[model samples]
Target: MAIPPGFLDELRNRVSVSEIVGKRVKLVKKGREHSGLCPFHNE
Candidate 1:
């Protein structure tokens, strides 16, 4: 049940926020971050 030390950091280094978020939402790069209209809030 417990995760190993540095597991999350290693996993995050291997993956990307855009790659994960892009799967469900349309993303646009804005400076240093990505943005998109929320499907639930639509704002």
Candidate 2:
């Protein structure tokens, strides 16, 4: 199947760790960034 063009680039740019983690953790705004527990893996 053919994937949509620029889809990967868009995903990389938009899929913030905070956005993803916020769904599963308590996220807080830290200055210009967001912080939260790692959702996809551990440090």
Best by lDDT: 1
Q: Assess candidate 2 and give its TM-score to the true structure.
A: 0.44
How many clashes show up in model 2? Answer: 0
Model 2: lDDT equals 0.79
Cα lDDT for residue 24, candidate 2: 80
For residues 15-40, what per-residue lDDT tens digits would candidate 2 score against the true structure?
A: 87667677788888999988776666
Q: Largest TM-score belongs to which candidate? A: 1
| Candidate 1 similarity to native, TM-score | 0.64
Writing each residue's lDDT as its tens digit, candidate 1 over 1-43 gives 9999999999999999788888989999999999987868866
Query: What lDDT does the true structure give each of the candidates?
Result: 0.89, 0.79
